[model samples]
Target: MSIKVIVADDQEIARTGLRMILDAQEGIEVIGEAGDGGRAVELAQRLRPDVCLFDIRMPRVDGIQATRSLAGPGVADPIAVVVITTFDLDEYVYAALQAGARGFLLKDAGPALLSQAVRAAAGGDALIAPSITARLLSAFAGAGRSAPPAQPVEALTGREEQILAAVARGRTNSEIAEEFHISLSTVKSHIASLMTKLGVRNRVEIAMWAYETNRVRT
Candidate 1:
């Protein structure tokens, strides 16, 4: 089945461009579009698309707030959100990430990457823009915090440690599998174990834990 998506941006031209790019891809479809954040939230709750593409700045409401409303920590049922923006600013990216967005992309990331990011979010993976990934995550790891990350109740095995580092460095599960000469299932097993031990929801949170503990430094 095609991955269903909702595009939310204040600009008609931007929404049109994104819809055109996504609609042209096989196995991907733009199911809806919203011109502002309030409508975006309403449509997302009603449609519950596979992925939501939101621009950061909008009238009446903003993308971050919309993201938070749909996928924030307090949400009972969180929808996957991929924040699309014209700006590459770290602060905006950080806020979006903290708001529980599954991925981030600059508007010019192009069709291939744009599609990849949508698929990644739908598949429970993350795809932050590489131009700002490391710097933004590293700084976010330490910013406005005075305490260390919660230590895992169970100790990390060597393999799990390796997986954590790889994820922290922005390596995908497929890449980690290849790097360790392990099967995809084994890689996922290690990732699952890591998530359980670290008490994280996904790879992004695992990466944050790694950075918070200085396992992967900038």
Candidate 2:
């Protein structure tokens, strides 16, 4: 099935550009567009698309607030949201994540990465900007507020540890496979094993634990 998406941005040009990019992909569709956060939230609640792409700054309400409304921890049925913004500051990234954004991408991350981020968010993965991920996660680790101290590393095998470290570094499955000279299925198996061992739901939580536990340095 084609992945349905909603584009929410105050600027018409931005929405159009994103739509063009997503529509060019064979298995993705842009179902709706909203110019403000309130409309974005309303449409999201109504349409229930697979993914919602939101800009940080919008009239009436902000993307963070909209994200929280749709995907916050308290929301019984949370929609996956990918926050697109011009800012790469740690505070903005952290705030968006806290608001339940599944992924973060800079506005200029290009169509390829933007599309990948949307698909990743929909698949319960994360696709943070490389620069942003390195800097922000490093700072979050240094702040020492995100993760608890490293517990026993568990019984993770060598391959699982390697995959977990790559995940912590924000490397996608394909990238990890390429880097390790392994097949995509093998990479996924390692990820599944790592997730089970670490007791995490998604890659974002794995990345968070990596930072908090000081396992993968920024």
Kindly list the per-residue Cα lDDT of model 1 for residues 29-132, writing each as its tens digit.
Answer: 99999999999999999998999999999999899999999988889988999998886664676677778888788899999989988988888777776665
Q: Model 2 clash tally?
A: 0
Q: Give the C-alpha miss distance for residue 134 in model 2, angstroms.
A: 0.8
Please give the CA lDDT of all the candidate structures. Answer: 0.86, 0.82
Per-residue lDDT, model 2, residue 75, is 90
Per-residue lDDT of candidate 2, residues 1-218 (tens digit): 99999999999999999999999988999999999999999998899999999999899988989998998777998899998888677455666676788778889999889889988888767787776776776666535344454453477788877887888777888889999999988988877777677775457666766777677776
**Collision count for each candidate, in order:** 0, 0
**Which residue runs does candidate 1 get wrong by more than 4 Å?**
144-146
Model 1 TM-score relative to the real fold:
0.91
TM-score of model number 2? 0.82
Predicted structure 1: clash tally: 0
What RMSD value applies to candidate 1? 1.7
In model 2, the runs with Cα more than 4 Å from the true position are: 142-156, 181-186, 189-199
Per-model TM-score versus the true fold: 0.91, 0.82
On lDDT, the leading prediction is 1
